[model samples]
Target: MKKIYSLLLLVVSCASFGQTIYTENMGTPTGTTLIPAYSTGTAPATFQNSSPIAYSGTADVRITSVSSGYTAASGGGNVLINAIAEYFQIDGINTSAYTSSGLQLSFGINTPTAVTNLLTVEVSTNGTTWTPVTYTPTGIGWTLATISSGIPSSTTLSIRFTSTTASQFRLDDIKVFNFDPSCTLALGTPTAACDAITFGLDTYTVTIPYTGGTSGAYTFTPSSGTVGGDNPATVPVGNIVVSGVTEGTGFTLHITKGSCTYDANAVAAIDCKPANALPFEDKFPYTVGSALGANQTWANANTGDSILAIAGSLSYTGVTSTGNSVSFVGTGAECQTPFTATTSADSGLYARFLINVTDYGTIADASTTYFATLTDGNPSNHKGRLFIKKSGTQYQLGLDAASTTTNFASTLFNVGDVVCVVLGYDFAGNTLKAWFNPTLATLTDATTPDLTSTPTTAITTLGGFLLRQDSATLTPTITVDELKITTTIAGLLGVSQNSAIAGLKIYPNPVSGGTLFIETAANAEKTITVYDVLGKQVLNTTTADSAVNVSSLHTGVYIVNITEEGKTASRKLVIK
Candidate 1:
């Protein structure tokens, strides 16, 4: 019983290897004969009438007749006869569909049980050369035989049967089967981008292509990074989404379904996170031919050159704003200024600039016309921008970051409109805030900001600030003036106190000489403190008399703080 069970298992295993590519039977011949047989090298099999032997059909393929080739019939109704030293061929069989498990050419043959070496079978790709195939016969009525060795790798193939010794042999029911397992797999492209503080979720969807194998659960494995949502997720028939992760590089998808494993191509990307700080400002107050004032200068951040000549189009326009303002024009033209910290402890920073769009000719919108930008050395590493654009008949203001843009407001200005733009950078929080068209004089008191964006990449350092119009034909004329960089909200908004300090008065407010007089209601001893525009305390002194000397102070705006009898008052002081 055990031997019978083992034999049954072998027969079942052989029967399971049935992915048939081609089949031929001698029934119902066509063309010039009753049966159609594929031929090669001038030898083709023919249909013969059933008589003595039939292996389940009334017709058999005959290679040659007794009168033509001097061979005896094998007496099988559905069989091919091969005489000694003569061969018959069956061509045009496609072997490309054969899988890695290999292929087998199967047929039923009837020959004398004693005739062990009756015939030899060979397979070929081109027909001139051939490889011999090993045949195993079951030795029963209409026995099943298979030739599985030396099968050509080519997609198109031919097989020949040749008789060796003088023996009657016939073939019928020719079939070819391949042992091909299912489930071939592949993956689609993944998603990538920079990190944003507000929206940090990056998503990628990969597809799996599979068919007709084991029906079971599928699993995915990443090469370098972890899968964002789920690990070893069930295989989706369509696609799967990988979400909720920071910037990653060199990610590859590996899929497994049952016994098959597939590895996709590796994908690489950049998700940067750098730090940033602020409290630096540029007013562009210089003469037409003078070098950019003191520590401030113009540079081409994109091209790495000093573009500070007085003869070029990016020089000071000599249009005085309290003194003068700078102008920029032409395509891809830009001017940048370096940042200097106003105080030693300054970390976060904000900047306010006045922009007057004088003439914009034939310019459509701000999609390509990047008028102002903040960067860290490389222009490609853009932190933020104030984009002036025209939408239809109305002009608009667009606040932009590395990955997203926010259209904040619409203005009434046609071509010539002066607008105030304020930008704040929070280095610790990785966020950018902006205010548009607010009065610069009272900006510190403005409660609401227009727009805000959180970036995924870190804005590590304030390398420079830039101004340009990236258009050639659309020559938009712009004038920039009254720029201020500061760390405090009061400094950024130009906060000033104009009222007298409780019956105390400072006469000749714009003190041009070396001496200025101070008067108090009760002639009390008072301590005076002066702060620069950047909120830096430059002078602190106590005075008992009515007069104070201010001879050494520079020509600029200063905030004066007066304290007397536990009372403190603040006011703006100017020196000329």
Candidate 2:
């Protein structure tokens, strides 16, 4: 009875814990396959065919059979060709298999390639008269081909090719080939438990060439020697690898036949566990001035430095010196995994913040907190601006009106309603824009979006500042990385925040007097807390468990505070 009661109590506690921590912020893709590689006859057996030779000619593919008479039976036993679906460009495709062709020979198959190789095809207007569809150059590799001009306007098309002048003809390999895309393989973030894992895969789009009569069986399975993980499901022309892949530090997805295999940053390899659905980011509680331990900052904060921390916490004494910059410190950040911008658009530093948001304390006060501090009036009379601090529910960017200048304004962002937020001041246009996710904020000259909010000249000259999150109230749960601040919008688009898994999240935001669940990683030791609207701590607890509770709290708007080690995270919670 005692054991059973304890177990039931534990379950209840977990349910209650979940009620307090609502996972909202989602992690970005650690890595993606922009361009994958595909090849004919590669190791790990990516394709199959009866007698398809791995297309390997440097130029356009060509095949000549002497006594075949353009007959399928006479050719080298039905030519079966298979190529990795995603990667490769078709160079050139031309069929010349006939010796005074009797009837118009036409056929083709549309697989991952541009089109099948066959003739005797035609296009009909109303199922009556048929017109020959013009042959077009497959975009795979061929650069020059103006054959798509005479294409008929009918879905039903038949083609017929007769050897009028020449009695002999030959066919070559479809032209398609190109370099492979880049890839990275890693877990949410590299920590102790499961950080030393990796996975590699290929990706690309292969254009088919040919029309009709090209029939054969095709299949796409996981590459050979795949130590584990579900195999890729074969599609009409592509293959989708939808499985939780886990590999040790040295695992390799070896490829053959000139196929490009990218080490896509799947997750931190450590967190690559099979789940019912795609894994979401783990949510951490948030607080201020939380201790994130040592090694959060670089040995010597300077240019060309990097740092690595999921929920890192740090504090700056003052924004002093001319060439000062704080960043996530680590070698991987410096070498293997450089930071990229949040999206391909927008302006900011790579994954980390450049701390350019004006108005830290209401625009007039000249005090920098968190990673930067205020300084005396400068030649430009510019007060420094502190960057964003990721809370459990919102991202605080910009300064309070009184902190920097009387014109400073900050932007707060939440999940779903706002996935990404960029607080920027465009100097060229004298504009302050706060873009949320896909929602663009047109500069309307409002007080919040006023261009005079911050000393644009001072902020620009600072070349931006970098700060680590340090929560003072309870424990901060939010995690931020890939912080970048830039003047040019083009530079911001180049940042990739999806590198580190950043896999932290909570669920059921705005809890209504029920269970609050928090799901996070094994290596994370977090502290969870609850607060009222008055900024008073109501509940505080710390454990390695994945859930928390707030059922006892009053029914109203509250804040959940999470502190891991010293890094604090906070999110607003509602009790029903």
Candidate 3:
């Protein structure tokens, strides 16, 4: 009688924790593919297919199988790369009513004996930061795993489930609320946990839950590695960053705060592919007066009459340029270059090119005419698009994260001026970042991006980049050169691996005047050697001051090689 009474009291107390905030069955996958968005929800959310950055080549289609109820599954083949991950985001979920309240998340997962990779659950409030709270059910049959966490009292709360990896697993029925069965602490660990690589060492960051958290001092212990982070704990209930972890190692994390001990399995980093090959880079290396699209490695919709290869490629600050430029107009056809699919963990595809709008169509038109866009598997969906719409005297260079025809970022551009564009999509964040004529410091630092927008439509994967030739009444005549797309931003801009030799910049690339500056990260003395396209070394000088006298060089295309601290990088230099 005494035991039964105590059990009943505990159950009643846990049940009184809170009410259901939001719940979703996630619907059923229409055959093999999971639907991008549920059209019924009032709350905002985004779903995406993600592959680890370490993986090389095209992304696999987000596969699903149905035995009865629809569930999310994974494709199998490669032993190393394994199956890609799925990211489900619950955005702007209002939890203001549950101030200082604890929350619970429950999901149903069923895996087969063949499925090897484990399912990891990560929670977050803001989109950028994430905390791995618990591991989902690993049982062979349908097993429900309910994890609890202290959710912050904000109207813009977000919970993310990263169905990281699997081959024969089925994940279905996800729900989030204050409590369903009770307020029991099933998997209430830290609210936030993430790994950061600093100087080749991996650091683990854990944040204390806001509402029902430990008080005073806490303890952290690793299974195999040495534990060194702020010993003798400061405030015990705040954020803690555990350091001194070796890279590529998995371990169990144990945190003790008074009696409420929290323990979970963790990895310094997820196991991913080792080498990623360069996707595509074209300087328009075609014969002068030759056609562009079809036979020239660039794919176009028609006979490729809309584009013509012109002489001399445009130059940017830190990137290498070669071959010729392509002049294009709105002629009904579109030219596209498909690269290796980007499954970047964070920022998706990084695209950089030099563009000069020669004519801004009609001055009275304000309707958007898209020029460049990052396309997906679907031929109709141009995920992230760049447009030029006439606004008053000048034209506004606009960027959109989705294929939406209307809204875009506004930055003025002139007729004859050359503009270097750096655009990329963040698959994990579901946002796109764009920059106009950014400097070496600007690109490397990743601050002051001209525009950033969340995707208006649910785009699954980014596979190619296209230059659309819209109607002549909409788009302007433009010249494009030195186009490159890759997995990483550093790779896209050709940034050096060594930090000391990074941030290389050359201004006024078509150097017509007297002096041209070559800058490096350390600002040390560097050797400048100029070579003409004929492979003849014309000028060589060593200078500490980042300046080179280009007056001696002739008016033609030349290669300027700069060696800083024994590290060499060549940039295409044109002296007029």
Candidate 4:
């Protein structure tokens, strides 16, 4: 075993303990890290003047005696005998390849004989100056000597090894430190996108490319980015289509002086997407569907579906009674308490109710609160034979039992009539119009109605209409098929065509217990596929169809992949 001890040196009668680690005669470091290169393995020789040993790259570091020198492996140069303190200052280490925020330097020593006269160990930056450290001796075996500090701070520095023999050190585990700063932004949480994620234009525009200490390229996907570990993308911006990423293992991202940079030992990447490339608010009308349950049938099966009345009555009638009051609740798709609407966006709501005209009468009572209540309704009030309780009292918008009311022309809806009762607010004219069977009898009001004395609240007490017959004593027995309430006119009008010039759509989206509908932006050769979470393809349809057979798929979360004209779009599909 080689025993390493401190050497005392005297300079001008001042005696101090000193250590000599390494000395290297150098060139600019050109080899890569951990890829078995010699450029990153050289260090400058050091001499202790009692002020703790340190040296620059110009200092001569001889690893073997010139008389019995060592060949520089299969590369160039030779290793000569001299103090080894300068070996600590290697070059070409990009430092960006280290994971997280720190660097690690690890190497081993091998000798023809059991050698152990090991002295001091150190690391440096710039391949010139170095920092010396003490090496503790363990048992007889040569274990890996690892020092984890001095990274980023000493990135340009190299490693130093001091010993009395010409043995070679098996170098491995070289790394960089402090790659992740203490002030890293906490903005990488995964979230579902609604409007495009805009980083407030001009917030972040530079891209850092990390290509060392790792082996592959990085890829940013629609929702996330993948590093060597396949984790979600932590890019600063929310939305942009960039490229120049390779797939590999062991990757890192770091920031310095307000600029981001990345490095990997075996990977290369460049920013392909531009900043703020696409930004536009989605203009689709707000939609809603009935609360899901086992015993419910929707006239329009779209969960976010809207029913439209194009000059006709849109009525919902249940074929049979399911013994349960078919009702709609204000729950969105996630079944989460629908996000409270701050404005019109939050007001996207609707209902689902059971309507049966057979054994029992269907009843709708929005009287969940006290300010509003259901009252005697007569359809003659609006050319229809239904009376409704409005605001503080019952106000009618129809003709006096004549049903001659209309929004456009002179179409009269008579008593005992049938019409689609559409209550929609016109944003353009700012009026609320109620259509009776499209146009037979229509009523228009110019003010937002106050259904409660607490005028600030909605008309919650107006929905439950008792379908009673015969003296009004017996509750009318009938089934109600569907009920929907929306803030947009188009949402209430269930039919709207897409006119955008993009090949993206979801079909049979308002899916029920049948085949799935797949719509395309244009007719072209496309690849329609469905995948589960485990990267397994559940369904693969290669033809072009507006609607596809999905009755064979089991109910669960499915990702529908549509590839047309080299553009791809994916949507989530649910089956119930």
Candidate 5:
């Protein structure tokens, strides 16, 4: 009995000898979402909420390294990564009571086997100044490691982990404490999206799912929107909602349970832009070989095979070819064009674009490839996607509300054929409709659509358009140009009929100042009026010369409406 009591006393003495002041076992991480920091557990131990780790250096994530069943993970990283965990104060620690020689730090580590690869730990009171304390590992397996060499001379502590060599490390059970009398240490994401706008209040309600936290009825508060929902509960688990959300803004949610709180990963509210009023068109009017997306209307254009504005344009039956067009050779990065946003109440929205398939690329068996989609502000949420599959040497076009395997067209169209494709969405009906090369009389909402499809899941919002360049196997040299999007079919047909005499070309588009050249088939007398994206008139002038003095216009996207006699041609212009 005396021997057992002595062992227990020795263990207690060793733990308290280090004066375990702060310890983080690290909170249990769930799901595949990479954890940004240890924010799940209680305060002082777990750095969260008020204490956030600047996990910006590299891919610092909660990894599922093997644990003998204690908790699931440790902070993990790859080679040559530097990360900083911000400091916070514990309630009872007195900095004056401890000295640099008496302080100790301990943690569990599992590192890569490279002999030169090492995990260097640095301590900092303020984030700027740092002191290195080395904890070299002897093996690749999980090892409880401790070191007490160099310590920061501050009450609170922050840590920076760096590895200069190509190695990996798992950090867990971290402790920063002392040797005299004080006590010892211990330790511890949400994807938020729009739910719906409650009918009565007419405000957006958001739902966020979290991976780490004590499971209970928690009241969630948004950093921007208010908390409200129908079939209400004071605290909601699984389902929580927020109202009055603003679009095109940075958004974050705070979860509260009793006195404890957790902050979810930051996300933005999808821009629920108003439905387009004017006819929005992009003729790919930039200089040939000029890559899309920098100071241009397209977003993420430089990502894929470089969404470059290649020479030439797609000529449609009624739409005259003017500027250069964009093509998809295979798949690389997805690109977005912010044209207009459609609300849930909107029933009709239409888009028309010219497509010409030069040749088909490698496609998986029985699988179709999507080239275009109607997306929300967060371009990932595709509302209605346009798909195409190869049927022999020819290609078949398809449409879906949100499905990849949506049916393809029965009529096989040949490659090298410039075809006008019109895709539309009816939110109230939850239907995706399309028409191929329709004349003015045939292009009415009342007329039966050429292709019709219903979505498997209901779509609520539509804010922009996205071009798919995502798959390597789904390769096809598809050229697209003369794109136009609007909420009504009248908006699609509102442009004046294309006549040879009235057909005009604007170039070295992305007018580089000097003089903006507008070339016509006749070079006839014309009056030009330019309007910005918001339908605000920026430039208006009557010029008989094909070249108008557009040097006065600032750099932006503008719609140049050139009127020749009674006929008018509206084209998109990007002033560089």
Candidate 6:
């Protein structure tokens, strides 16, 4: 024998965040004609104060039994015999306010027998071609249905309930309410600080606009770093401190309430430190045709192939203050140098270089193209990277570290702009900072860092410093000069002027015959030292005579330091 199932549609008025467009209880006097806003069919049901059964209120509408219009079934269960078609519609329903999830249509039903083909709920705007609504309950003890078929676009919408079986059917407490099962999450601005520095513990606050779900807790996940100070199991919508964040770290807040969920993302802010002295400097004073072989200080001549050439060329022109500068065009052209002070315990180091970007080729969004990098030879230990790429029409500076990239400052760089870039690492804080277009005279700390990375694991030892174009498609022409790496800021800017050596003068500033004449105060023991542009000590001598032979030195710019009676002064010496 085949099993039979009966459905009882039960609807109740319930409070919800969404607005209720329409509702009806059918609590009218007995023997009153059941008149909806609109009606159809030759014969319709009448409103009865007491029906076969009332789920809630005192009255309901009933479909009377029919005799002849029923149809026989093919499969041979209980045939739908004497089926009567009737439609009672409530009009003037504006469904435009409904969200993409649609609204709920509910009503109470009282059926006497287990009839398979008994009733069907439908809706339409023109009242001619109706759409059927599936009977799916969403609330407890209530027969719920959704208008998932989408309500008609007309203002005069109508909902009709059709009964087809001979069994009498009753409906009451019809309601149309919004079914919004989603929430809105808002995480406001979060406070941030440098590593180890205290500022309210870098706490942040968040709030949920609608918390109407079963899940009470929320989870905070960082994109590239870790977060702490709040219980992950039962995090609420309030102040929660964040930690272990590095530069470019983004956070996502996840919340689940009942059957709904919401999420939001935000970034943390950190401050940058100033530049310090470096152990190496390079001015690229080699002539145009000179071979770019490895020098005493540099690890390699120049590596990588140019995009437009078969081999990378370090031969470049357009000298600025110095006699020469290195040019990199196309892709992969680069220069690298090795330094012994690569350990994190070196405290701090600064690397500064002057660059003139003549072109910034077509670039796609989020595509990284590097201009300079400091690495520890090990691919895993990428100390820091400085990059500039196109973001829309403007070029922006970015810093890459700890496996994340972050853009800093609103200042945009364009083609033909000559600027100095200073990259520094602070071992004390384990952070990286950068400055763009800094004043070379004073080497003042960039008021605001172009970019800064959060405290990370200290790079114990560095292998080499590199300047290259990492993008294949980016064919930018850049001239780099005056590259310097020092451990103190004053060393890069200039030594302080000494008043005791004011009367001393160096004659034949641009000496050609390799003979330098120095005029010093009488009866003073003076010590002189000459350093190449690379900060390499080339010549040192102590003399009472004024004339010094420099024939052994090459043609270039050098810094001459003179010390007399505990007073020191520095002068630039140009060899021709």
| Angstrom error at residue 144, model 5 | 14
In terms of TM-score, the best-performing candidate is: 5
Query: lDDT values of the candidates?
Result: 0.51, 0.28, 0.55, 0.30, 0.58, 0.50
What TM-score would every model get versus the actual structure?
A: 0.34, 0.21, 0.39, 0.22, 0.46, 0.38
Q: Please provide, for model 2 over 350-397, each residue's C-alpha lDDT reduced to its tens digit, 9 standing for 90 to 100.
A: 111222222122222222233332211121122333334544444454
Question: Alpha carbon lDDT of residue 491, candidate 2?
Answer: 37
Which has the greatest lDDT?
5
Off by over 4 Å in 4: 1-327, 330-419, 436-521, 524-576
The all-Cα superposition gives candidate 3 an RMSD in Å to the true structure of 21.2
Summarize candidate 3's per-residue lDDT along 6-117 as a digit string, tens digits: 0000011122234545544433222233233232212211122121101111222122432222221111111111255754455666667665446666655556565443
Worst 10 residues of 4 by lDDT: 9-18
Clashes of 1: 17
Candidate 6 segments whose C-alpha is farther than 4 A from its true place: 1-279, 289-294, 301-303, 306-320, 342-344, 362-366, 377-381, 402-404, 439-447, 496-576
How many clashing residue pairs appear in each of the predictions shown? Answer: 17, 165, 2, 102, 12, 17
Error of 6 at 485 (Å): 1.1
Candidate 1 on 277-365: residue-level lDDT in tens? 23333333233444231111343433211222222112222211333456555453355554543322445567777776666656666
